[model samples]
Target: MDPFEDTLRRLREAFGVGRTRPAEFRAAQLQGLGRFLRDNRQRLQDALAEDLGKSAIESDVSEIIMCQNEVDLALKNLHTWIKDEPTATNLFTKLGSAFIRKEPFGLVLIIAPWNYPLNLTLVPLVGAIAAGNCVVLKPSEISKGTEKVLAELLPQYLDQSCFAVVLGGPQETGRLLEHKFDYILFTGSPRVGKIVMAAAAKHLTPVTLELGGKNPCYVDDNCDPQTVANRVAWYRYFNAGQTCVAPDYVLCSREMQERLLPALQSAITRFYGDDPQNSPSLGRIINQKHFKRLQGLLGCGRVAIGGQSDESARYIAPTVLVDVQETEPVMQEEIFGPILPLLTVSSLDEAIAFINRREKPLALYAFSNNNQVVNQLLDRTSSGSFGGNEGFIYLTLPTLPLGGVGNSGMGRYHGKFSFDTFSHHRACLLSPAGMERLNEIRYPPYSDWSQQLIRWAMSSQSCTLL
Candidate 1:
């Protein structure tokens, strides 16, 4: 039997019914999820450590706390999100009152990636439930330990009929997609995202794809070298540079590169100590496959600061490579690891040109104190999202619509955006009994006089009808 089918069966049996539209039941489920996280916080942290080698602090802050916050935000705003929103009617339809009703898209499928596995899965699930939809969450099998824990724990807290966690690899995922779903949400690499999208197209089901790309960072001469270095080091090395929004490469003037390299070295050492391989703060690559990919990129550029690796433990130190050409493999692909490549250009215009020559990046960062330089970069570059004078902090904001465009991917979800994503905005018109007489002129059989009267009626701004 298909694993998703079996899992869906279990969920249906647990909920004691196949489906339900009770808002009160959804509220209770959200409240239960909040209580589950609060009570089992340590377990979640331990699972993250076993699965991805994330430090206790990183797991607590990024995974557990963020997931809990999403649940809390949804619970607080559910009443408003569920309410009907009245809309203004056009003059032609003035006799009827129009409103948009937010309705759930039946069963939802969420395919989450390995990096930040819990957060990516649970955050979207919060929106799915808040919008009153059933969800079948497929946590990444790459993070087996975390996936096992989720499969065990989620059912304990949520309404099993409404929410379920399915376990398996790609084959299982393919089987799950074979069945129709009301909506699907996927997060991972662009290559795999295409497969998900293709499958979703079969059902004509709407989807939200959050995929990664070669995100770029530009450091201008006017910026403070030390401050820029510190910020870049923090973001690049955070989660071992596995973050999708992490700066993939640096573009700057040759003179600025000379001033920035030493400061970057200082920041890396400060954060991870002399030997990052032994540092407790730095995380290891999730698996050997990723570790080998980073090792291959090191051959493409000269090591500016650190280039150390341990294949056995899946460890790669905070590495910085300089003098990397655009054709180099490191510059070509999305470096989803702790290896930062630096490409020096003579002018800011050259830097912008270099960025424009490639596919649109998921995120862009420009470090400059000059307002003109910042404004120019923002106006010219095409990216899914960007930050000026900062690094990867935009991903932390709950209000922003977080997703990609073009090759990076499509669709966005966060805060109220998620509610809108999982819902179908159905327009409704309410007309009173007496309003039928006014709409008679819009009815079928037409004479020349009636046509003139119809045109006059539409053209007139006054409420009076002819």
Candidate 2:
């Protein structure tokens, strides 16, 4: 007997009965989710801290607040989003009305990552529910604390008849993937993204993959070194640099690199203090495996600042590396740790060329006092998101979509896009059943004169009015 069969069947039945199609039901679920975030704010923060060594402020701002905004946005716009969108009718179809109905995709599966477990799990859930789809959320087991809370408390907030929280690592996920789902939204790495896509392909299931890439940050010679250092350091080190959109490496000139090193060193010290391992603001690695991987990376690039690591605590200081080779292990992979590597480029054109050579990044950052330099980078490259003089702060806005392209990943979601992602836009036409005269041209069989008259009426621009 399949363990998830009963749960999947129950949800599919609920969806079949049209229990989730109404705007009121969607808004209710959104409000329930909003209350869940607000009521359990502290608990969620503690769970995030326990699971990933995230600071309370970091958890609140990035995870809790972002999820809350998604909930709020969905609740506020559900009615507007659910309405049928009227479309222009062709002359032949002028007697009928054409419109698009945003309908649910039935049962949806959401596989969230461990880095920002709650936010990733619930944010997509908010969208799936708002689009009138029942969802099964599988929170990352690596984030045990947050996963526990979601498995237990989250079901109580949302309607259990339609929503479920499944738990497990790879084996269980594999088993779950065997079952057909109407849609799947997965937030993880590209390696696993292939697995999810392959699973979805068996049933021709639609999928949205939010995967990561080595996001590049191009620091130009024109900017204040300290400002660029601070912004880059904060986002890179935020959530211990596990963020998918974090700037993975710095591309700047040798002169700018020299200036950036000192500024970055000062900024790291100011933010995390002399002993970052003991600092409350700093975070630890999620597990020992990741800690060992990060430790191995420390040996590649020459350490420029704060290369310290403690295996027992799974802690790596806000570190920097210089003289990093393009082919070195540190330069080759997405460093999902607090270590920042600076590779010198000869000029702005050279930096752009280097970025163009690699796979299109998930996010790109260009920092400069000159707007043209930033614009040039923006125009020259393709990335999921481009940050000019900023970091991943764009996530705060529900209007903008977050996603990736090419090697990074595909599909986008956030606020309304999330709802639209989980929904199917169905084309609908309505007309009186007995409009025999109006539909005569659409029917077969006619004399030459009748056919000519009908064709003219159908093709004439003046025939727009019925």
Candidate 3:
């Protein structure tokens, strides 16, 4: 017997019966989600610590608080979001009601990654529930502690008929993908994103892929090295540099690089302390696999500061590498760890050209006192998100969207964008039964006068004053 078969069927059956369609039910679910975070704050923090060595503050700020905020936002605006969006109609349809109905896309599958397990999982789950879809959440198996907590405890807070948590790694995920879902939302690497896309294609299901890439951060000579270093180092090594949107590499002139090196080193020491491995704020790598991978990257460039690794603890000290070539292994892939590489580019145009030559990143950063440089980077380049003299603090704002372009991924989610992604905007129009007279012109009337009238009614000119 297939393990997921019964659960998927049950959720689909529940969705078909409209158990989650009511605004009250959605609000209840959102409230329940809120309670789960509030009630299990410590439990979740412990789980995150065990899995990723996340500090309690880091877990709350990045994962728990964000999820809570999303749930609150969705609950507060559930009625407004679900209300029929009224649209303008042409002259011929002026007497009819035309609007878009935000209907749920039945069964949804949310595949989350391990880096920030709770945030990625529950954030999208909040959207799915708000949009009134039955959801099956597959939290990352790699984050076993969080996974266990989610599987064992999260279901207690949600309606089992409408929501479920599944357990598995790649094989089970592959099997799960074989089944059909109305929509799929995946957050992971571009490599796995392609697999998810391909699986979603088999059933002709729409998907929102939140994948990561080599997000670049460019520093200009006009900026203060210490300030820039403080901002970059904090975000780059926040989750032990396991952030998808973290500045993967740095691009600046050799002169600026020289200034940045010591500043970055000082910032790291300040943030993680001289003995970072002993700091409570610092996190360890997820597992041996990732630890080994990150440890190998240390050989790419000369370690300017802090290139220490402990296999037993899965700890990699907050490290910065200099003189890294563009073709180096550290630069070739998304360095999703506590390692930052610096590469020299002589001019702003060269830096722009260098970034343009690569796959569009999930997020891009530029540090400069000159607003024109920031604007130029913004206007000339394409990325999912851009940070000017900042890091990914924009994520905390629900008004802004988080997504990717090109090889990074597809689709945006955060706040209302999340609600929209899980919904299908069904176009609906209701005409009065008594409006038979207006219908004749739109029907099989071949007369010239009727044709002319129909054409005029269909055009924008007849709708209102120009």
Which digits, one per residue and each the tens of the lDDT, describe model 1 over residues 302-391? 998888888988888898998788888898789989999998888889989988988888899999999899889899998888989887
Ranking by lDDT: 3, 2, 1
lDDT, residue 371, candidate 3: 99
Each model's backbone clash number: 0, 0, 0
Minimum summed lDDT over a 10-residue window in model 1 is located at 11-20
What lDDT would each prediction earn against the true structure?
0.85, 0.91, 0.94
Give the poorly placed runs of model 3, Cα more than 4 Å off.
Answer: none
lDDT of residue 431 for candidate 1 = 79
Please give, for residues 1-466, the per-residue lDDT of candidate 3 as tens digits. 7889999989999999999999999999999999999999999999999999999999999999999999999988999999999999988778889999999999999999999999999999999999999999999999999999999989999999989999988999999999999999999999999999999999999999999999989999999999999999999999999999999999999999999989998998888788999999999999999999999999998999889999999999998899888888999999999999999999999999999999999999999999999999998899999999999999999999999999998999999999999999999998898958768777774799988988888888888752
By lDDT, the better pick of 1 and 3 is: 3
Q: On residues 50-94, what C-alpha lDDT tens digit does candidate 2 reach at each position?
A: 889988888889899889888887888888998999987766667
Q: Supply the TM-score for candidate 3.
A: 0.99
Clash pairs, candidate 1, are none
Question: Lowest-lDDT window of 10 residues in candidate 2?
Answer: 457-466
Question: How do these models rank on TM-score, best leading?
Answer: 3, 2, 1
